[model samples]
Target chain A: MSRLLIVDDDRVGVSALAALLEDDGYQVVALTSSAGGLEALSAGGFDAVITDLEMPGLHGLELVRAIRECSPTLPILIVTGYTNSPAAATAVAYGARRVFPKPVPYEDLLAELGAALPH
Target chain B: MPADDLERVYRWGWLPLIGGCVAVTAAMLAASELLFIHYGFADPTRLQRVLHLVRGAVMSFALALFAGWYMLRLRQRVEAARESLRAQQAAFARRAWKTEQAVGLGALCRLLVHEISDPINGLSLHCRLLERAAGRMEPTDAEPVRRIAAQLRDDTERLQGLAASYVEGNRAPGSSERYQDLSLEEIVRAAVAAHPCPEGVEIVVEAASDLAPVHAEPDRLRQLVEYLLRNAIDPPAGSHRVRVSMTNDGNRVLLAVADDGAGFEDPASVFRPFYPASSLRASLGLAIVRDVAREHGGDTRAANREGGGALLSVRLPMGERTS
Candidate 1:
């Protein structure tokens, strides 16, 4: 099983996505803060990082940049409500693998994880 | 060009005025000579005296004609200059009014986007969670809950689409509607370079180095690439890498953005304005992308890649006009 880290400032959203992903059969660790996400990321063992673009501290793009420095090939997916902004593109340039807008489809998320965490 | 036209009018005005005066002077001198010949039959002394009076009258008439011609020429020049000034002032006023309207509209859009974005995002997030919970329930119980969640999601997305339209439509009053020749490769490369890319996500550009340029609005095209790239690599879509390429067919240039990520379940719904199931529906990003393409007399389409993932392409007509 592949290990994935999910981060979002919205507690409800983080938990819900975690539950959904867990049901899809991945080893999921969900956190409501970027600080916690970063800590978990630094400890290693995560196959991929999934995060919300808009967050309280260490925003999505910033976290992606930080993660890029450590794991050059780790898959980073950004979930955002504001997909139209320049920040979306900036997130990708900073090393995010992809950006999924809010209310992501379950199957698509699964497929992306499958590709990213291919054992 | 207007100035040149006015200059031509001035030339025509002066040429006629000067020519008419010279003709009048010649006619007057001829008439004086005819009168002098007719008076030769009079007594010698009376005729001499008559000649003296005629000379004075002719001199006065000549002077008066010269003064009238000079005054009329001065008036004509003044009128032309005044008209030119008025035209310039009117143009300046129009420009100022357009600037004011654009600034006001820009402020309104910013304020509205700021106020409404957070609440809508929150609502959509919760609604998704509700739908997810509803899915795990008994079939009989889940149906209504799922229906309501779906309804709520639809409504929330409609509002989101409206907000996006407002932002896109809030163009400045005098924004350029003109198209210019643009290199697709340059724009795509720039946008890709600017976006933050995480590991395992590589953007492979497959454009021919000498591909033909497309006629397009540069800023809008840049936005289109940004939106497409974001959607292609978005984690839920499941592609770890993306390929952006360009080609030409007939009179248009085709820009294709493809991802090895999970492809769309329904390719046709991608461009619909408020369909939530489609990945591009969140902010109606795909709709706007399609609209932009259409505005340029072009078209956009989405399709499932044969192996996996998705392919989104836009066709922009070649611009023939030089800016």
Candidate 2:
């Protein structure tokens, strides 16, 4: 199974997403904060990361920037509440593979994730 | 619009007209007198010259008085025109202020809706998960559980659509390229079918034959039709029946929706967005209808029906529209 790291401040949302991903046969590591996410990524063997936009300590873009600097080729995807806002475009510019608006459309997310990592 | 400017015009505007008139009159009199005396038309006597001077002064005063009076009347007319223009300017300013307030509220609602939609989305996604989990189980009531999840998901989607309709209602009407040639009657029929009738309420939709198609934004138009139907079917006092009629009047499409419900206490207040929070839904529905009508180069009106219900009408240009 390919491993995935999902980060979000919304614990319920993160848990629900993690459950869904896990059911799809992915090894999911869920975090409710981005504070120690960088250190976690440094020791990571994850195939991809799925993150939410607004979070305490580090927002979506800042985390994307950090991750890009550390692992340039790691597939990064963002899910945000503000897709119409510049956050989505900016996330793509900062090396996020794509940004999905919440509540995450699971089918699309799954399709994108499937394309990002081999099953 | 300054009172002082009018005051100044009244005080000084006529000085040149009257003064010039008087001067020309006086000069003409003196020249005639000199010419007559030099040509021997009259004797060069002191009494004659004094009489001529007195006559000239009287004529000058008469002419100046007449000219000043006429100018004062003309000035009054100008003042009237200015006052009318000032009233129009004030009215326009008031409308602009209202529009600005609506726009500000729209921006706030847009952000608020996005914030709200996220949670609604989550709730909906949870429903999806519930359905998926039920799929793997062989429980006796599995179908019912799936049905409940499906309803919850559908309701959440409806809530999102309602919020979006309200947010769009608060927006300014301007150019938009997303429009299609659609039948007004067809849209009304679809709305009627989609919107559930309130308990004890029956809805009847009537359309004139051979109704022409209109260029419109179908989604917004459908929302408007649904909102109208919703309002008519459900009121505090309950409604027995509702009737929606559509017709083509020359180059425009006309829609009238009438409901036998608790009639509007204030028909004018129905469309205002800044009502008590309790009436926010009604306000939102009406505002959406109003703005959507305007965006399509149409208008909406509300009135208390003569036989006891409320009557609402919408008229739209049958020509092509950008939005």
Best by TM-score: 2
Once model 1 is optimally superposed onto the true structure by TM-score, how far is the C-alpha of residue B133 displaced, in angstroms?
4.0
DockQ (C-alpha based) per candidate is 0.07, 0.13
For model 2, residues B1-323, the per-residue Cα lDDT tens digits are 46677667667878887778878897889797788878996866887778878888888888888887888786887788678878999999899889746644554365456557557766867888899988987887688888899999889878867876775564446524446668888888887786767678888889887676776667667767876887787566267988899888765688899988877888876754533245555556776676556545455788898899989888765644334
The regions of model 2 sitting more than 4 angstroms off are A25-27, A43-45, A54-57, A84-86, B1-11, B21-54, B91-95, B98-102, B132-138, B141-143, B159-323
Interface RMSD for candidate 1 relative to the native interface: 9.6
Instruction: For candidate 1, give the docking quality class from DockQ.
Output: incorrect
* CAPRI verdict (incorrect, acceptable, medium, high) for model 2: incorrect
Residue-level lDDT tens digits of model 1 in B1-323: 36556567555656765676667666666676677678783444776668756875686577668757776776677677779888999999899779745543443354446345546756776687788789889999999999999999899889888876776676545444435678888899998998777678989998865578877667667767777887776656667889998987665688999898878778888765554454433435665666566445466789998988899998776655343
Compared with the true structure, model 1 gives a TM-score of 0.43
Q: By summed lDDT, which 10 consecutive residues of candidate 2 chain B come out lowest?
A: B272-281
Each model's fraction of native contacts: 0.08, 0.34
Which parts of model 1 are misplaced by more than 4 Å? A1-4, A7-40, A43-47, A52-62, A81-95, B1-70, B88-121, B134-145, B160-323
Could you tell me the fnat of model 1?
A: 0.08
